[model samples]
Target: MLKRKLLTYALISGLSFSMGSSFVHADVTKLRLAVETTPGDPLNIMLASFRDTLQSSAEEEVELEFFEGGALGSESDLIQLLRAEQVQVLPIGSDIVELDSNFAIFDMPFMFADKQTARDALDGELGELLADSLREKSGLEVLAFGELGFRIISNSRRPINTPEDLSGLKLRTPGSATRILAFEMLGAAPTPMSLGEVYIALRQGVLDGQENPLSVLEEFSLYEVQDYVSLTNHVYTPITLTMSANSYAELSPDMQEHVISAAQEGAYQTRQLSDTSDAELVEAFTSAGVAVNQPDLASFQTASVPIREAIAERLDAVFWEQAQNILEPR
Candidate 1:
């Protein structure tokens, strides 16, 4: 059995976790997994599945400590904890682009025709390239890529039927340069903030709109504050399950297999959940008295051309070309 020595205290975002406070048998190995998402959010669901899968299949005793709802802090803060070996695993969203800009490809508007196309590319060569770049640049292990689904716009303002309707509206987005630039090109004033701050900002009129997967509306109870739901379906983001290299390296080979297998299983469940949630949430939002509209995507797609072209030029030429080739019509 593989045994891990526990640190007495690990600090993250000014919070300390007592890893060694609890007694454990010498044969038990503890894994720390966290996400900044709410309890029922996709990221949290995936993490729970990973923990269950790993514990069920592992040869030795596996103890997992699950932290959710920004308990450890924001996604950025979680990344830092992983880097410091304070946290062993994290499921991160597009904020990961900050770690390696190569992931900014996900921020490109209208990039994926559908989830399958996006999944195909990510489960194939393009995924490998991005994973390799991240591993080489940051000593993290990319276990699996789970779906964040396609991002749609939600607003307290009037219904958005076209890109013109977004004009001058203050939209909250993650701190992604390409994503912000895309919204700017579409005529919205983009505001970058942490996920935890978005709801209050919208409620207080600091942001007129925000974009995220439909599940976010239900997960964060955003429907109460946002009146209109625009089916922009602009960007498809994937949450990556990443492990600290230090933690992964310390695992025995058999235990490492358990980790990888569990991650893949959890990722698959998230993809299925995203596909079903999109259709169901539309009806849920409408019943909640929110006006939902399908915007003129052609106009949005047309306006997105420059940003795509610009991102292609900024990214590695080989990766860009190969990603295009992999995502091309079959």
Candidate 2:
């Protein structure tokens, strides 16, 4: 009787151990990431690099699942999922950060001088400061910051060489206060819409124009709908790789290090892909018979000064000043 009892006890213990091991393995093996861009877009190309690198380097089996091109819903929806720990990671536009208010700094028009300047700002001390601020304020971990390239204007109407040209033109913009104010300051009627709707809206003449990076413009085939592409470079946009604090806390220390490292590497690669795609997109637009023009950027800059001042006023002078300090030569 004693022998039989021992055997049964051992069997139960063994089964419990096996189930625990399986649960641990399952936790370590799965990751779900969301991105708003299509699979072939530069953003996805960069994410693929991260996915590959993480799979190769992790000690445990790792699988990355991507929800792309609004298949997972809009950025706002994804953020909610991240907060709920349903989604593990999101590569989202800076505009999405406005939901947290602290991320509003990135929306400051002409805040970044160029791509290189923006890269330096985000990858340097300022980037760390911003990332830390975001983690503290929003309960999300910013693994890495990347470039979406500078945003330019694409319109079905005449080329916008000066602020006057934008007058009365209905322009589609992201649902950020800064974006709306920027276009409003420039005298254009800014319509806030989801990116997925922009292409259709433009096609149906619901919007006179929209703004985005060259890669985005090309990805959505906006070139086919819009006749004029103006290199306004009005806003320097950054793409952030964000993870839920709850999800991140659940990772083992080793896994956490691996995840952050992989994201940083992916961000660097994505920036390169974005740069290359920007150049290629210009050619693609030209080939597609879109009239591309490099208008004097000075006019755009001059027009934005008042808009910046207004934003600074609303955000309080100190916050705006600190942001400027971060961008200034150091």
For 97-132, candidate 1 gives per-residue lDDT tens digits of 888877889988888899998898888887888888
TM-score attained by model 2: 0.87
Residue runs of model 1 more than 4 Å from their true location after superposition: 1-27
Worst 10-residue lDDT window, candidate 2: 15-24
Clashes of 1: 0
The numbered model that scores best in TM-score is 1
> What shift in Å separates residue 169 of candidate 2 from its native position after superposition?
1.1
lDDT of 2 by residue, 93-205 (tens): 85555645556666667777778888988888778877777787788888888667788999998988888999999999888887788788888999988888898999999
Most lDDT-accurate candidate: 1
RMSD values, in order shown: 5.4, 10.2
